[model samples]
Target chain A: MKKDRHFYWRLFSSTFTLSAFTFGGGYVIVPLMQKRFVKELKWIEEDEMLDLVAIGQSAPGPIAINTSILVGYRMAGIPGALLTVTGTVLPPLIVITIISYFYIAFRDNHLVKALFKGMQAGVAAVIVDVVIEMAARIIRNRRLLAIIVMALSFIAAVLLKINIVIILLFCGILGAYTTLRSKHDARSSPDSGKDESCAEGSGTGGSAGKKEGSD
Target chain B: MIYLQLFWSFFLVGLFSFGGGYASLPLIQEQVLKINSWLTPAEFMDILTISQMTPGPIAINASTFVGTKVAGLPGAVIATAGCVTPSCIIVLTLAVLYYRFKGLDMVQGIIKGLRPAVVALIASAGYSILLTVLFDSDDYTFRLSDLDFIAAGLFAVSLFLLRKFKLNPIYAMLAAGIVGMVIYGFLPSF
Candidate 1:
């Protein structure tokens, strides 16, 4: 009983501290998470760290929150997920609440205005940087389909101004179709691919918390 | 009354805010500025600045700021809860089910498709933020004369620093603010 309580407390406090102190959003928090969980605590493996980041980024909402939940769930379960997520969001809720009270004062301040306008330009640049980095990673895969989808999606978003939700749905369907077709072709090939079912089975099953780059 | 609205609005923001928190800004702008008039354009910009300055994700920061502005302490709680709930639910469900279906070719394909789309969404989001900084919209039209060249130059310099020197974004943002203060606040440039 005592161990369980201690574990939960540690989980909450570590996540809370990480979220509270980290600046620059999700990307920044990721490395900190690696340090705390993989290095300091030894709770998760290095590769699992990457998987958590991948799943977190791919899912909805904030990557920080998603990662916290995943890490928590990986360690414990639903309760851990709840605890970590609460810890992750608490600092921002507190900080922004205080700022809201001072909103009028800050709004009318000349220095703050100039600072924010300048920061906005910097923020624009950061977003551009994010785009370049993400594109470069995708390009490394050398998948023509991925590249084509990325370009088309960019056009639809930037030029045509299509709705974002619709675009995601369309791409998801296309991806599933292409992948499924390719898998079918491989299975039907005369080579028949020995150990295919073994590979598929091992891929699906949880490996005693030792999952490492199944993809 | 307002609390419920805040929750519902942020709930929608959470649900559709894929890619990242930055991608959620348009949804936020639409709900808070256009649909409800909870904040004016200038106030919206302030929220954006605060969101960036703060530690959490922009979505959480924005929701908290807007909620507090709209209702108060309880408003902040409800709004943040709403914004975060969808993610929690979605992630928890996936955490349970994803590995179970991990080997399904269709599943991998769906994720593969979503990856490029997410990249596009992120790029589009950056473009939107850049649009606000680079161009001045007056009477619903962009004017070349209204373009702020100084801000554009700062943006280029910041991007260069980030890519070339691998500078942390916080420092880049701070440097840009300092430059802005020097030019707009002290230099007496029009």
Candidate 2:
């Protein structure tokens, strides 16, 4: 029981410190989490960490929180999940709370306004980089369907001004339909397994490979 | 009632915030700025800036900031809870299903489909922010002469640094802020 308590405390503290220190976003926390959990602590294997990250990325919500939940659950089930999330969220909640108290004074400051104005441009630039990088990966895969979907969705959102929720739902249903149809086709063929693996590889393998290369 | 509204708004943000932090911008923008008018575009941009500079996830930070602005400490707690609730529920359920099924093809396909759309959402969000930064207007009707050349220049340089040199975004933002302080803050005539 004492050992279990220690383990839980470590889990909470690890996530707490990580969440407290890391900046930039969820992606920035990935390698650190891997280093801490997979390398330092040896809590999770390397590949398991990768799979957890993949799942975290694919699911809705913040990748950092999703990842913390997965790691926590894998470590100690629901209680672990709760502890890790609280740890993960507490840092920002505290920091932002303190900042919020000073926000009114900050807002009226001329220098602060100027600073945020500049930071706004930087933020926009970073988002553009993200778009370019993501789009390039899809285009690099040479998947015609992926390319078309990318273009069409961009058009729908920018030109037609459609709600993003509608766009995501439409694409998700379309994706499932196409995948099911392709599976049906493969099932009737002689080499079904190979085809399915190939499709899966092309869909996710690109990002996974890039992540490895970066590491 | 306001607390409930804050929770529900952030809950929806938590539920549909796929792709990552940048992708969630549009959804949060729609909820806070468009629907509820809780924040102006400039304030929204500041929230994004603060989120980037702070620790933890952007969604969480943004929620806390917005919530506090809307309803103080209790509001911040409730809004943050709302943002995290979907993540906990969805991730825990997925964790169970993943261990049981190993790999689900339908989930993979849905993710595959969501990728491109996520890119689109991020791009659209960036486009709007870019407009606000450069033209000082979120609307599309700004004249060419209305463009802020200094901001445009800073954006281009920052993009170049991020892509070519792989500079950390936090540093880029800091550099931009210092530059803005010197130029816009000190020299109003230039």
Candidate 3:
């Protein structure tokens, strides 16, 4: 019973390094993981990377953490996912343990204060940069819809203090609707010379965006 | 007892976090602010700033910082472990079942629905944090004078240089920090 565990090892190694070295939290991890796992290693393809990001963002947990889980599971199995997540999480855990011992001693140091103050500005910049990258992807697909949803939600949260969960649900519904409708339109077109009209929205087979790479 | 509480609570957060850690911000905030009383809301923001400066998950950082604050080094260890243990458990379990569900229609349908919601959550997180940044302070006053306009002008220039021109964010951040310190030193109350 031989198993190909190299994929798992690679994922674990990459995710672990990513977790350890990442600065400014989860936002920084996404693109780094993308560059390493997708471009450097070629373990996952480009479109798949996009989809992976979408799912990782849409679900719960840390991006690197959940990504390791999903990608690990895909590559090997439950054990693989476990290994990958641990590999990623363990380094930071250890580093933080060490930092905890010494943070108090240097807590009031001028350089440390300056570093943190700089990071406050950098952290926001990083978040915005990542958001722009993601928004670029969505905008490429459906510019108007993406802008509308983004602007509307931005306004709602900024002005009305709407809940995040509620905003997410609304966007998810709208995205699905548009995606499904586009698929339906594609199928119903006379290009294939098929006269079939999608009668039931739920059971119709034209769900074009269901592909792993597309999601 | 505190360890157990942290473990159970974060385990639940891990299970329900469907889109990633940002989605769990509100939940984590509730636990830390309302239920646990480990850190005041203001303190939590400070921890956030610290966490962003360092490596690792925000939740994990929060856990460690709060735990240390509350119960020392031991508490930090417990909290950090508690924060991550759930994903370890869940991700491992799901890895086994990945193939069976990979091509499923229902799963895709559900995910198709989940995507936009995730976007909304991200946007909302940004917004929620913005409110906290802008309005949560005691002296939350805005003056529309020329000096203020100069600060705004600098902010815009920085935003564009960092965003459009692709200047390094770390540099931009450091520059802003320097500008902040300088402005404070000079104007004091401008």
Q: Residue by residue across A35-153, what tens digits does model 2's lDDT show?
A: 99989987776776787888898889998899999989877778889999999999999999998788767787888878888888888888888888888998899989888988898
TM-score of chain A of each: 0.79, 0.84, 0.61
Q: What is the lDDT of residue A101 in candidate 1?
A: 90
* TM-score of model 3 (CA atoms): 0.65
Q: Is candidate 1 or candidate 2 better by lDDT?
A: 2
Model 3 chain B, poorest ten-residue lDDT window? B138-147
Q: After best superposition, candidate 2 residue A194: deviation in angstroms? A: 3.9
Question: Residue A192 of candidate 2: its Cα lDDT?
Answer: 86
Q: Which residue pairs collide in model 2, if any?
A: none
Write candidate 2's Cα lDDT for B36-73 as tens digits: 99988888888888888888788898899999999999
Candidate 3 or 1, higher DockQ: 1
Query: In model 1, how large is the Cα lDDT of residue B133?
Result: 80
Q: On lDDT, who's better, 1 or 3?
A: 1
lDDT tens digits, residue span A1-215, model 3: 12456655676788788888987566678888789877897656665555555555544567767776766655455666677777776766666656656766775656555444433444444454555665666667776656677667767654665654566556666756766776578677765333222222321221222233222
Interface RMSD of 1: 2.7
Q: What is the TM-score of chain B in candidate 2?
A: 0.95
Error of 1 at A46 (Å): 4.9
